[model samples]
Structure formats: structure tokens, C-alpha cells
Target: MTDKDLRRAVLDELDFDPSLDAGDIGVAVSEGVVTLTGHVGSYAEKVEAERAVRRVRGVRAIAQEIAVRYADAKKVADDQIAARALAIIDWSVHLPKDAIQVTVSGGWITLTGAVPWRYQSRSAEAVVRQLSGVLGVTNRIAIEPRVPPGAVKDKILEAFRRSALFEADAIKVTVSGDRVILEGAVTARAERDAAERAAWSVPGVRAVEDRIVAMARADKMRCTAARIRDRSSIPETNARGTDPSGGRKDTKCSDRGACPVA
Candidate 1:
């Protein structure tokens, strides 16, 4: 599509999401890449705004230049924000209360600690990201599973079977240490994201490398493109067997069929 049409579509998509305030955000397109400019009230709004633009078709890349303008009523002391962040993490059942450390400075929340699973690390960050007066979050929580990491494929497959949203047969799982590589195809973009999330939820997973391709692009491109999934769960599959950034694929599978990470 032309740059003009792409620009209109991106703007419309920004407006379509109820969670984002796209009015003050400016959209610019060049060769299918979108650049977001303007100031947002909070960091969450800025993130959601970019997420909204990503759903639009033909968006090759994004340049986020939006500044965070904290509302006066939303401003809080660093100590107050840290206290609330701790409370939030403590209340989340998906996260281990004592396993996470929170630090706040200049409206940014930095998470540090060791968790047993990738999901827990992410869960901790997600909780802090929603707290009022937060401008940004830095998630540095490490995944250090205590249990030996074997049978990851079976565990992931079982997870897919138990979940109604995932198709177990359409995807493949490979484990290296606490890391995982997911390869296969899903019927939809949301399904691909769900598959990755499921992979992360399993214990012993320190990282998840999504390589699952969405069925939507199967017709436009070859079905066998070697693709790696992004952390955001955005669809970027192709036959090249490389990530969207054209980086080399991960190949650390062990003979035991999985890495022995403890």
C-alpha cells in the first residue's frame, strides 16, 4: 500500500482502541514504517498507543518518540510509588512475593530478582506498569528455575492441550537450559501470542523464543518460512528461518531432547 493509505490506516487503528488516547499523538508513515510523536499522560497510554498501531496491516516498523507527560494528580513520591508497587506484587497470585525487588527513581520502576518461570518475571513487571504515576518499567528479574529442566516439550504440549485456546499439534517446542524455542503455525495472531504465553507459564522457562507463524500470512508467503516470535507476540513469520530482524535462529537443543537446567 501507498504511504498515504498506510498513514490513514494507522491513525484509524490508533483511534479504534478504547484504551489509548490517540488525539494528541501524531502519526507519520514512510515506506510503511510508522513514527509516533507527541506526549502521553502516562507510560501505559504510550505503550497502548503503539500496540494499537501494530494491529494495522502493512506496518513494517515503528519509531516511538512520544514523551511521557505525567498528570499533576497522577504524580506521586518515589517512596509512595515503591510502596504501592510492592503491594501490587504481593497481591498477585502469579508472582512470588519475596522473589522480586522493586526500585523507583524518576517515575521509572526497575524490577530485579530471580523467579522460577518467565511468566512470573513478566507478571511482576505487568503489575508495576499499571500503577499510577509510573512513567516506565525496567524488568530485570531473572528466571532461575530450581527444578531440573527436562521434559519441557511434554510439559509445554500438555499446557497447550489443557488450554482451550492453543492447538498442540500445530506447534513444536525445543528447550535449551531455561530457554525455549517455539516453532509451528497457529490459526490467528492471538493464538500465536497465547502459545508463547503458555510456554512462558510453564516452570523452568527462563526465556521463550516464539517462531510460530500465523495462518493469516501463510497465503501471502510460503508456509515454511523459519520465523522467530518477538517478546510482544507480534506476528513476524517467514520462510527464511530467521527472526524479523534477520538474526540467526537459536540452535542449542540437547541430546536429552531438552536442556538440563536446574
Candidate 2:
């Protein structure tokens, strides 16, 4: 498809989603890359916007330049946001009690703690980003492995074998200490994501470096483009919260417990 057609498709996708206001959002396409610009009311909306663009066909990559802007009436103080974040996290059934700490500065929250599982660490961030006036979240939570590195590799490979999504032999797994590096190529982005998920599902994996690439076949590309066009006509339920920068490097927790507002 031409860049002009791709741009129109992206804009239509963004507008069709009920979860976000696409009034100020701009879409510019070159080749197959989509560049998003402008501002949104919340970080969640910004993320949803990007997701909408990705759903369109012919989108190879994205450059997210959308900014988060909170209205004055909805603006919340740092201390208030911190307190609310702490309360919500503590109340969550998925997270460990008192295992995560919250720190807020200028509407941004930083979570610091150590969890036995990657899901727990992600859960802590997911609950807090939905709070009012949260501009962004910096998840500094660390993962503590419970098994040997060798076993971790075996488990990850086993996971791939058990799943129908992966080719098993097509993907290569490299384990260094508790970190896993996945190197391979798949036909769709979902498969690459599945490989990463499989790697993280292992007991002793503390980190995952996904080097998998998605190379769509000619027929698959045509199907994907058709699917994008079809989906653009339908509306879906709204889900909240997102992070522009997918993940962060692990950092030592300097301020333990609930931190004071800065």
C-alpha cells in the first residue's frame, strides 16, 4: 500500500477506538514506518494510540512522539499520587505484601523492590499507572531467580516444545547466568512475543533479551492488511495504562519502603 493510504488507515484506526481522543494526534507514514505526534490526556491513551497504529497493515515500525498532558482540574499532587499508588499496590492480590515500594516525583512513579516472578514486578507497575495524574512509571523492580541457570534453559526449551506458536527448532535460546537471549525469526510479531513470553515463563529467568524478528510472507502480508482493514470498522472495549519505553534496566533500591514525595 502507498504511504498516503497507510496514513489514512492509521488515522481511521485511532478514531475508531473509543478509549482515546485522537483530535490532537497526528499520523505521518513513510515507506511502512508510522510516526505519531501530538498530545493526549493520559499515558494510557497515548499507548492505545500507538497500538491502534500497529494494528494497521503496512506498518513496519513506529516513532512515538506523543506527550501526556493532564488537565488542571484533574492534576494531582505528587504526595497524593504516591499514597494512592501505595494503597492500590498493597491492596492487589497479585503482588507480594510490602515487597514493592512507591516513589513519586512530578507525577511520575518509580517502583522499587524484588519479586520472585516477572509477572509480579509487572503487576506492580500496571496497578499504579492507572492512578490519576500519573505521567509515567519507572519500574525498577528486580527478579530473584529460584533455580539454576542450566535448568532455566532446559525449562524454556521445554516451554517452546509445548507451545504450538513456536517452530521450536527455528528459534535459538542462549542463557547467560539468569538472563536469556532469544535469537530467531518468525512470520508474525505475535510469535516473537510468544517466544519471549516462553523464555520468561521459566523459573530461573530474571531477564529476557528478545532478538527475534518477524518476517511476513507475501500471502501473510496480504491477509494481515485485509485483517487490519476489517478490524478498523469494529470498536473494542477500552483498556487502560501503557509505557512508551517497554522496559528498563534493573537498579538497586536506594529508598526502601514507601518514599516521601519529592
Candidate 3:
């Protein structure tokens, strides 16, 4: 599609989404890349606006320049945001109690401490980002690598083979200590995301370097756009996020609990 056409599509998608007020959001397209500017009322709405743009077909990449602006009456104190963040995290059954630490400054939350799984860290950020007055989240929750490097590689490859989104042979996985490096190319952006998610699901993956490229395919973009639109109507769920390869199982820890490995 031409840049002009893509720009219109993005604007329409943003306007169609009722969860966010798109009046202040600006859309600009060059080639297939989309750039979002201006500002929004909340961080969640800012995120929703970007997601709305991604739902449009022919959008290869997005440059998010949207700022979050809160009304004075709706502004929340940093200490309050911190307190609410801690309480919500403590309430989540998916996260180990007291395993994550919260720090808030200028309405942005910074998470520290350690967890046994990537999903726990991700869940912590997800829950906190939804709280009132949150500007952004910085998740520094480290993962405790429990399995050997070889087992990590094997588990990731097995996950890829089991998923319909990937051709296991097309992607290569390299394990160095607790870090994983993935290099390959897939046809759609979603596939590349799935590959990285699969690698992080492994037990010993402390970090992942995603080198997989998504080749531009008009047909795939159209299909993904349709799915995105369909999903936009569904109410958001708070369950632990699911990956394309079934889902990752949480590792069982000893009575003492999984401690952060220095």
C-alpha cells in the first residue's frame, strides 16, 4: 500500500478504538513505517494508541513519540502509585510474594528484585502499568537461571517445533551461559515475537537477543490485521499472558523459595 493509504488506515483504526481518545494523536507514514506523535491522557491510552496503529495493515514499524499528560484532578502522587503498585503485586497469585520490589518516581515505576520466571516479571509490569498515574514502567526484575544452558536450548527448539507459527529449522538458537541469541527470518512480525517469547520461556534464559527479521509480506499483514481487529473488541483479561506455543509452566521452587542468583 502507498504511504498515503497506510496513513489513512492508521488514523481510522485509532479513531475506531473507543478505549482511547485519539484527538491529540498524530499519525505520519513513510514507506510502510508509521510514526505516532502528540499526547494522550494516560499511559494506558498511549499504549492503546500504538496497538491501534499496529493493527492496521502495511505498517512495518512504529516510532512512538506520544507523551502522557494527566489532568490536575486526576494526577496521582508518586508515593500513592508506589503503594498501589506494591499492594497489587502482592495480591497477584502469579508472582511470588515479596519477590518483586517497587520504586516510583515522577509517576514511573521501577521494579527490582528477582523471580524464577520471565512471566512473573512481565506480569508484575503489566499489573503495575494499569494503575492510576503510572507514566511508565522499568522492569529490572532478574531471572534466576535454574537449568543448564544445553537444556535451555533444547527446550526452546522443542517449543518452536511444536508451534504452527515457526519453522524450527529456519531459526537458530545459541546459548551462552544464561543468555540466548536467536537469529533467523520469519514472514510476519508476530512470528518473530513468538520466537523470542519461546526462548524466554526456558528455565535458564536470563536474557535473549532477538535477531530474527520479519520479511514484509502483504498477505500476512492483511491476515494479522484482521485478527487484530477481531481481538480489539474483546475485553482485556488480567490472566497470566499466554504464548503461541501452548504456555510456559512455572517452575516449582523449594520451601525456601527461588532466590535471586547473584
How do the predictions measure up, each by TM-score?
0.70, 0.75, 0.77
Off by over 4 Å in 3: 16-18, 55-57, 218-262
The weakest ten consecutive residues by lDDT in model 1 span 253-262
Every candidate's lDDT = 0.75, 0.77, 0.78
State the lDDT at 150 in candidate 2.
74
Model 1's number of clashes is 4
Q: Put down candidate 3 lDDT per residue, 1-262, tens digits, no spaces.
A: 6899989988998999999899999989987788999999988898888877766656768999999998899899999999999999999999999899999999999999999999888899889988879999898999998897778888988999999977786677888889888875556556777888899888758899977655556443443433344445443333555343243222221112111110
Supply the TM-score for candidate 3: 0.77
Best by lDDT: 3
Candidate 1 wrong stretches, greater than 4 Å:
1-6, 30-32, 57-61, 159-172, 183-191, 211-262
- Any runs in candidate 2 off by more than 4 Å, and if so which? 1-9, 54-58, 219-262
Residue 180 CA displacement from its true place in model 3, Å? 1.5
Give the clashing residue pairs of candidate 1, or none. Answer: 210-229, 225-238, 225-239, 226-241
Total backbone collisions, model 2:
0
**lDDT (10s digit) by residue, model 2, range 1-262:** 6889979988998999999899999888987688999999997788778877766656667899999999999999999999999999989999889999899999999999888888888788888888889999899998888988879888989999999976886577888999998875556556767788888877667889876655555534443333344445443222544422233221311112111110
Comparing 1 with 3 on TM-score, the higher-scoring candidate is 3
Candidate 3's displacement at residue 173, Å, is: 1.7
Pairs with backbone N, CA or C atoms under 3 Å apart (clashes), candidate 3: none
